[model samples]
Target: MGKKKVSALVLATTMVLLSACNVNMGGGDTASKPADAASKPAGSSSSAPQKVVFWHAMGGSNTKVVDQMVSDFNASQNKIQVEAVYQGSYDDLLSKLKTSMGSSDGPSIVQMYEIGSRFMIDSKTITPMQNFIDSEKWDVSQLEPNIAGYYTFGGKLYSMPFNTSNPILYYNKDLFKAAGLDPAKPPKTYEELKAAADAITKTGKATGANFAIYGWFIEQFFANQGSDYVNNGNGRTSQATESLVNNEAGVKTLAWWKDLIDTKAANNLGRKTDDSKKAFSAGQVGMILESTASLKGLVDSAAGKFEVGTGFLPKPADAKEGGVVVGGASLWMMNNKPNEEQKAAWEFIKFLTSPKEQAYWHINTGYFPITKKAYDEDSVKDNLKKFPQFQTAIDQLHQTKLNTATQGAVMGVFPEARQIVEGAIEEVLNNKKSPKDALDAAAKEITTKIQQYNKTVK
Candidate 1:
């Protein structure tokens, strides 16, 4: 649990062009060592440690956690040194990573969002984590199946799940009580949620609810309805050639969301998650749908103001009860690196996913640990006790069934498809078009993009 100061030198160098790897080291200036060198394995000796560059998209408080974890890993080992680099947002990281391919300076390990799984696989520039696991015969039974399910396809885990999260319903318990609703009995189905929202609005306790118009949430709704986002078994059994977001489930989900906005039960926050979070934390909204990763921020923002409560995301009453897809990023090892570098990167990944490190990560950040063993750790248990709301996310994830819909849609153009979905949502909320029409148009466009992507990958 010791925090280490991140070297400014690494940050300064990392900000340079993505294609550049040369770092200017003053005479006798080796990479800054951790303050506690005693943590290094005893009697372990090696030549110059193999350096691994890790490019990640984590920012704000999450970036601090990544730096601390990297420092801890570096301190605990003597044969490998990892330089963690902040590579802007997830989209920015993907762009830069694509352009840096085939260059000698590309990162040895990169963190990409879950939606980019198919693209990473098709790029053919990644050494699938499954390859390493299979070669070493690593026992991965302890890994969270629901989280691993998203990154796994064709019976292989292409990337290592890190910073995994799932969406949940976060509500202001004080606001619920003021609205004459039981804070302990949060809404479970769409009908219940609507009723609660209406009561909350009528009582003037809060603005009922609000959530960002994000495609991820739409996808979750589809999953909750047991519907696929794309054909070809949600793009798991084979390559996805088209998008299925225009189906009946998609139409129903969008109609419900539009009704909520039109009825003034929920505010249309557009695509700015921060705006929605701000509204909820300020007690202006009774409930909000957001990733579990927002727990820490929401709690801190509402501290001494209101009590926060969390529950599984609401599903349609008529739909079969289903769970959510994992959101967040995963770690992928870059291909074509030197054997030593590849092995070193894998070692760092293994260390990061270990029970102790995962527990520390889960406690510090709101992200769920990918390993089941992490929850059994004393540190994790203590943190869970302090904030029992965190356990709701675990329970929600545990209830998730391993199915095509829950595995999430996979396509080379998934990022673009998400943007299209968001655009369609805006159209519906703005009353420019009905849900079915908007979704149909979006599905058509996404299908074309997917077909084009398939051709290229083929």
Candidate 2:
């Protein structure tokens, strides 16, 4: 599916460059630590503690949680000293990581987005977390199965799921009541949603709805309708060779959304979720769909203004009922570090996944706790009581039927493919092209990229 075959001369030249870089990619600055130390973690008697460089993309409000977690881990340990560095957004962090691949200045552990799984495994720049888990005989049953299921492929966990979230219908309950609609009973299907939006817009105060034109939401819609984004069982069984986004479910999803815009039921607030969130919090829009990670922030923003409420993601009436996929990033151990350093990094990871730490993270941020035991913590119990709205997503995740569609698609070129899908969506929304045609075009482009990506890995 690649657009064109590369000439042998060019391919060989690129290989030669990679070969030169590969020779020096996994060494240098490993620090001085005794490899023979039998006892480590917090009780090592070794004079020089193993140094670990951890690069993460967590920013804004959640930054303090990560900082506190890392600080506590370091203070509690004598064998490992971890330096956690904030590395911009997920995309920026990935770009910088690729640039630092051949240098010794790279991190021992890094946080990467979920879509980058195939690329990370193909790059061979990191060690699979499964390897460490096997050696340590770690019991992983405490972790949430659905979340872990997304990260596991071919019986291997490439990374540790840190923060997890799912999309939900966030609505202004006060606006719903003002519009004479029942705030307690939100719409569950596409047709029902349009009716509610129309009702809300008829009121003079606010528009009916305004969801961002994000590709992640599109993918969720596909799952909600029991549709696959790619072939080969959503790329779980094998490397997907083509995209299947222009199918019946996809066309209907776009058509219904565009109809909302055309009917003046929903506002086209551009592609930024922030814009839509602003409108929702200001009572300018009645409803929006966003990840549960925005729950705490939205609750605070709408405080003393409009009441906030949540519902399950809406689907097409005729479509089979499905569930939402987990969103957020995971932690990976880099292979560039020494074995001792890698071992120390695992200790820090375990510390973060502990019931106490997971509870702290869940209460402070809107993301779900990775371990089930975190719910038993008094902090989580108290926080949930205060903001019961968070329970909507928890119930949604629990109700989801675990299947290929809900598990999400995988590919080495996912980030690029998302951009292409967004372009197609923009075309559909702006009337530049019909939904089918736009998606068909984007599918062709993404297919070529996927093929080319597979070629490089082979």
Displacement of residue 188 (Cα, Å) in model 2 is 1.0
Tens digit per residue, CA lDDT, model 1, 1-458:
10111222232223232214432211111111111223333223456788889999888888999999999999997878899999877757776886676667789889988877776776567777887787677887879999999998889888999888888999999988988889999899888988888888888767899979888889999898888999999988999998999998899888988888888888887787888999998899999998888888898899999999998888888997567999888998877565557777878999998999999999888899999999889999999888889889999999899899898888877767777888999999999999999999999999997776665544
Kindly report which residue stretches of model 1 are placed more than 4 angstroms away from their true locations once superposed. Answer: 1-46
All models: lDDT?
Answer: 0.81, 0.82
Q: For model 1, name the residue pairs that clash.
A: none
lDDT of 2 at 159: 90
How do all models score by TM-score?
0.89, 0.91
Best by TM-score: 2
So what's the TM-score on candidate 1? 0.89
- Residue-level lDDT of model 2, residues 1-458, one tens digit each, is 00111132333333345555554444443422212345345325468788888998888777888999999998886778889999887756776887787677889899987777776766667777887788767888888887888888887777999888989999999989998999998899999999999999998788999989888888899988878899998999999999988888889999998999999899898878888889998889999998898898899999999889999999998898678888888998887766777888888899999999999988888789999899899999999998899999889988888788888889777777877888898998899999999989999998987777666656
